[model samples]
Target: MTPLDQKINTHFPGLVVRKDLVRTVKGNAIVPSYVLEYLLGQYCATSDEATIQTGIETVKEILRKHYVHRNEAGLVRSNIKEKGRYKVIDKISVALNEKADVYEAEFSNLGIKRVLVDSGTVKTH
Candidate 1:
């Protein structure tokens, strides 16, 4: 355990986690630092190296399965096309433009830039 880890465990007990766990868990979550730290505290609030490593993996897995990434939309679409169906969790928005007679789509986290979509095709999240 690093000095900070030992310090936190010594002074704060179960209230805080090791610093390395925070770094390992932060990827594409786009969450505030405190929120990530709080979750780390919940899952990895330990000074033991083995326990901290396990907690890091747990947090990373949670983010991988649940966090939305702007770069993964194409991969999800490809999977759906290849496999006929796939599970995806995302936030999607589309607006119908009567004047243009087309649908404009926006993916909040997928970084899609105003795609012209066929009308009544699919509205998905």
Candidate 2:
């Protein structure tokens, strides 16, 4: 384990992420760092220290590559098309309006809503 992992495991056994660290961080809009880190940990955690480190590096690289900046949505869209599949990290939530027959998708940063997404995606998730 990395020192950070070891420290976390020692102090907060069975807890996946250090959620408390999120609030202390200051920024314009804080979307819990623990959420991103926790996702990274899901892909990286291993009994083998070297593999874990490599996995951590790989996940961070993916985040750096795919996480969009304002002008980079086109790049991300191209990547998704090229890769045929991609995991997009966003504040995605489902909501029902007065017309309860339909489900709405809310993409936080992209500011998109009620786009036609395949029902299979929801079922799989």
Candidate 3:
């Protein structure tokens, strides 16, 4: 461990989490390391193995309940289509069609394409 790591652990043993905890909890979430680490810090930032395990399960449960998988994005979109709104976690990209004078959005996860959008929208947000 680095000196800072050692120092952090020595001062706050339960506040620093193992690096692998992020990987263990991130199955198909496709999120950034900081985001996963933040989540782990919330529940599993401990050296105790048992507590870490419990925290892992807790994080997984939270992700399962909230995170959206790319494969299942269709369901979410369909829900929104039928019900007018739905929640989903997805990587979306948008581009400007200068020739067509419109904006196009593609939801890579949901496999949706050619979604017309406002030109004022930010790209790849």
Candidate 4:
């Protein structure tokens, strides 16, 4: 097991995410850090520290390679269409109305408003 993984398993059994690790992720994309960290959490939640570190590097590589800037939505959309699937980091917040029967995605800085996102897209930090 990697040292970080051992530390997390020993000290943070109930914590699903380690936000402190996100700072190690390198990128210039404008999206909130949590978004990238969320993706990292998915792949790097390992009991072995070395594996986790490798996974972290892999996820950072993905962000550095694929994440799009706000002004490049058209390029990103085309890439997504061509690639058939993609993981994007964007600022998203949740809103609950009176009825609470609906959900909307507020894309920060992209100027996209009220787009619907599946509940599955929401991840717990």
Candidate 5:
């Protein structure tokens, strides 16, 4: 870590991600760069090289397990149905359904639509 890097890490721990490491963690996933950076912020925020490497593996594992791919939408849906609930990372768009008088969410990559969302979540997010 250089002097500037060390200074930044000192002042803003757990909020900084090394720029080069972004490419290292980003692998063919269609998600935006901010998403990857957010994950990196959680795990690779420190300037320690060893910790950053371990965090990179952790972020990759998280993407492999939780990220929803467009091609595997059916499988992911099946898994969610079978398991009752499952956590996934994907782009979501929420809108109020005028006809139903309810908030609904659409998962872009997961290919799921009309999933009801609570008003609180809809407002907060």
Candidate 6:
């Protein structure tokens, strides 16, 4: 790591990610760049090469478990129903359903739609 990188890591630990590492962890997933960066920031935000490598593996495991793909939407939906609640990483859009008088969320990549959302979450996002 360079002096500047070391300084940045020292000043802002757990908030920065190396650009190259983002590509390493991304691995053909059709997710946003910010998503990878956010995951890397949480796990690999450090100048230590060893820790970064381990963090990359951890992040990969997390993506494997939580990230939803379009092809696997049905399985994920089944899992959610079976488990009652499940957390997933996917693109979501929320809009007010005027006819139903409720806020509905659509998970774009997951191919799930019309899931009811609370007003607080709708307004916050």
lDDT of 1: 0.68
Q: TM-score for every candidate vs. truth?
A: 0.44, 0.54, 0.56, 0.52, 0.94, 0.92
Output the lDDT of residue 5, model 1.
56
**Window of ten residues with lowest summed lDDT in model 6:** 23-32
Error of 1 at 62 (Å): 0.3
**Could you give candidate 4's per-residue lDDT for residues 1-125 as a string of tens digits?**
46776786677543445665676664444546766666766777666678778878788777766666777877777777899876676666766443756667776644556766556665442
Model 3, range 19-98, lDDT digits (tens) per residue? 77777777666766775676688787655678778988887776665556677676777787998876554556888888
- Highest TM-score model number: 5
The candidate, 1 or 6, that scores higher on TM-score is: 6
Candidate 1: residue 24 Cα off by (Å):
3.7
Stretches > 4 Å off in candidate 5: none
**Per-residue alpha-carbon lDDT of candidate 5 for residues 13-124, written as tens digits (9 for 90 to 100):** 8899777878877866676788899999999999778998999999989988888989988999999999999999999999999999999999999988999999999778
Q: Assess each prediction's global lDDT (C-alpha) against the native.
A: 0.68, 0.57, 0.72, 0.66, 0.89, 0.89
Tens digits of per-residue lDDT for model 2 on 5-52? 777666764345433322322134334475556654565444455765
Clashing pairs in 1: none
Candidate numbers sorted by TM-score from highest down: 5, 6, 3, 2, 4, 1
Clash count of each predicted structure: 0, 0, 0, 3, 0, 0
**Which portions of model 3 show Cα errors greater than 4 Å?**
1-18, 27-59, 123-125
Clashes by residue pair, model 6: none
Clashes of 5: 0
Off by over 4 Å in 2: 1-31, 74-86, 117-125
Residue 54 in model 2: lDDT: 70
